[model samples]
Target: MVLISLVTGASSGLGRVLAELLCEKGHRVYVIARRKNLLEELKKQCKNLEGEVIIIPGDLSDGNFRKKLISQILKKEKKIDYLFNNAGFGRAILFEKQNKKEIENMFKVNVIAYEHLAALVLSSMKKSNNGRIINIGSVVAFTPLPYFTAYNSTKSAVYGFNRSLIYELKGLKVTSTVVLPARMKTGFAEKAYDCYKEKGRNMCIEKFNKIAESPYVVAKNIIKNMNKGKEIITPTLRAKMWYSTRYFGFVVDFVMKYILGPKERKHLEQAVLKEDYKNS
Candidate 1:
């Protein structure tokens, strides 16, 4: 029997890679994103693959879109075997500088959309007693960065939701696995930086780009762990290190402040001075 997988944010990055991987493995995949062209391109690329791709182009932050997405899937697929809750983005900006709409959008996409979509699919999954919710969280869920406060909060919510789900799913074949990945060499960073750039102002992403890993490799590890029935996964060595030491507040904070590389260090200083001046 073939599996049915739903991957959100499938226009690019980890989500796109995961959708492609699922199709290659003979699983019928439903890819969702705002960019219709990219989703269409992905479907074309997977046309001759072992499985199939169904593209649903819309914004996950929209509640109606999420419902329509699940409704369309349920009409044909019967039950979804895998829910790759991977639709999210991060912007690096000072908390005080972040607009209200920006914060709401972040929560809507990263936290609300994931939870709402999971809830929408859970009924069918639980009734069948066979399904998996693969939550695409980040290491920052545990290790919150200074400038990415709102984004970190959203990821932390993802971790919390998935962990609670595991217990709620006890004695059932249905499971929720949260995978925290390190920095990925994807459009995520570029988009994040671009979103926050205000003429002369800049967000330093040099170090982040430097330490990034291939999303393809990360997606492979996530699939491997999912198959092995793992609940919590930190795929990369760097991700593991960052997550493992999350509890060491003082050390992590120190490292986050002073040892995040000179560029980031300098950026942080400038941000602080600028904020202080504005407030004063």
Candidate 2:
């Protein structure tokens, strides 16, 4: 039987890698992303794969788009075997210095879209008695990072949602797995920095880029864990460390702060100072 997978944010990064891997493994993938051109490119690259690629380009933050995406999928496919809620982005900035619209967009894409899409697909999955919902989260969800308050909070929501969903689907074959990945060497950091710059400000991402892992490697680990029947997937050593130390709030916070490096440290200091001055 051919498996059907739906991967959101499949234009780039881990999402794109995951989609490609799925296609290579003979699973038909329905991918969604804002970059239509990149989606086309991905489709072309995977044309000769064992499986196939179906593109649905749209903004995840748009409720109508989400609905239409589901509708289109249901119209074409009978049941979705895998749901990869990998569509999200973050901006590195102090909470007080963040853009309201951007923050809202983060919540919509990271939290709301994941939940809404899961809900829309759950009934079909439950009725079919088979499906895996993979929610792409971040280590920041477990260990909070100072300048990424909004992004971290949204990921925390994803973690909670997936965990609770596991219990909710008790006794069912439908599994909810939350993937908490560490920094990945993908377009993610660049996009986040660009978004922050668009807000007319500078933010530091040098440290993150330094320790980021390969998106292809991350995607491979995620699939490995999925096959292992794991509910919580922390593929990297760094990601596993964050998961293991999740409860050590003070230690994690201190380590996270220092991990920012000097450049980001100075950027944070300046951002906080500016915010304090404005408040005063």
**TM-score of every prediction relative to native:** 0.90, 0.90
* Residue-level lDDT tens digits of model 1 in 227-275: 6557799998988998889679788777777776344535555543454
Model 1 weakest lDDT span, ten residues long: 271-280
**Model 1 misses residue 125 by how many Å?**
0.7
lDDT score, candidate 2, position 14: 93
Cα lDDT, model 1, residue 265 = 34
Stretches off by above 4 angstroms in model 2 are 194-203, 256-263, 268-280
lDDT of 2 by residue, 1-280 (tens): 8899999999999999999999999998999999999999999989989989999899999999999888788878888889999998987675776789999999999999999999999999999899899999998887776667899999999999988888888888888999999889887776565332325534445546778888888899988777544678988888898788867877866766676434454555554344433452
Query: Each candidate: what lDDT?
Result: 0.85, 0.84
Predict model 2's lDDT versus the native.
0.84
**Span of 10 residues, lowest total lDDT, candidate 2:** 194-203
